[model samples]
Target: MTSLMALVVGVLYAAAIYMMLRRSIVKLVIGLVLLSNAANLLIFTAAGLRRDAPPLVPDDAQVPAGLVADPLAQALILTAIVIGFGVLAFAVVLIRRAYEVVEADDMHQMRDTDT
Candidate 1:
C-alpha cells in the first residue's frame, strides 16, 4: 500500500509539473490542483497507513492503550484541502478576469497584448 501510494504521488507530481509548464492558463490551474493533491497525499503517506484504532483515550486512562492512527496528518490534510480549494478558486477567478480582458488564454498571446 505504501509503495502504491508512493508511486501515485510520484505520478501526480510528474503530471502536475508537466501541466504547469504548458502555455494555457487552464492547464496551469489544473496542474496547481494536482500539485496540491500530491502534497496532501505525500503528507498522508509519510504519516503511515496503519488502520489502527482512532487516536482516542479511554475515559479511565490518560493515553490510548494501543496503536492509533495519527491525527496530525489527517488534520494537516484537511487544512490543506480547504486552503487548496480557496487558492484554486482565486486562481480560476483571476484567470477568468485576465482572459476576459486580454482575450487570450495562452500566456504568450496574453503577453503580446502588453503593448
Candidate 2:
C-alpha cells in the first residue's frame, strides 16, 4: 500500500510539474492544486499506514491494545486540504481578474503588454 501510494504521489508530482510549465493560467492553477495534493499524499505515506486499526483507546485501558493509526498525519492533511482550497480559490479569482484586465489567459500574451 505504501509503495502504491508512493507511486501515486510520484505521478501526481510529475503531472503537476508538467501543468505548471504550461503557458495557460488555468493550467498553472490546476498544477498548484495537484502540487498540494501530492504533498498531502507524501505526508500521508511518510506517516505510515495501518489496517483494521483505529486511533482510539478503550475505557479502563491505559493505552490502545494494538497498533493504532497516527492521528497527526490525518490532522495535518485536513488542515492542508482546507488551506489548499483557499489558495486555489484565491488563485482562480486573481486569474479571472487578470484575464478581465489583460483580455488574455495566456502568459505570453499577458507579458506582451510590458513593451
Candidate 3:
C-alpha cells in the first residue's frame, strides 16, 4: 500500500511540476494544487499508519504504546492545506482579473498584445 501511495505521490508531484511550467495561468494554479496534495499525502505517510491503535484516548485511560496517531503531522498537514487553499484562491482571482483586464486567457495573446 505504501509503495502504491508513494508511486502515486511521485506521479502527482511530477505532473504538478510539469504543469507548472506551462505558460497559462490556470494550468499553473492546477499544478500548485496537485503539488500541495502530494505533499500532504507524503507527510501523512511519514507519520506511520498504525492500525492496531486508535488515536482517540479516554479521559482516564493511559495512552497505549504505538496507538497514538501523530497529531503533529496532522496539524502540519492542516496548516499546509489551509495555506494551499489561500494561495489557490488568490491565484484563481488573479487569473480571473487578468482575463477581464487583458480580454484574453492565453499567455500568447497577452504577449502578442504588446506588439
Query: On residues 8-105, what C-alpha lDDT tens digit does candidate 3 reach at each position?
Result: 88999999999888888789788988999999999988777655555676777787555566787889999999998998899899999999988876
**Which candidate, 1 or 2, would have the higher lDDT against the true structure?**
1
What lDDT tens digits, residue by residue, belong to model 2 across residues 1-115? 9999999999999999999999999999999999999999999999987784887888989898888899899999999999999989999999999999889888987876588
Which ranges of candidate 2 are over 4 A from the true structure?
112-115
Q: After superposition, how far is residue 86 of candidate 1 from its true place, in Å?
A: 0.9
Q: Which stretches of candidate 1 lie over 4 Å from their true place?
A: 112-115
> Which 10 successive residues of model 1 have the least lDDT summed?
106-115
lDDT of each: 0.95, 0.92, 0.84
Residue pairs in steric clash, candidate 2?
Answer: none
Pairs that collide, model 3: none
Position 35, candidate 3: lDDT = 92
Model 3's alpha-carbon lDDT is 0.84
The count of residue-pair clashes in candidate 1 stands at 0
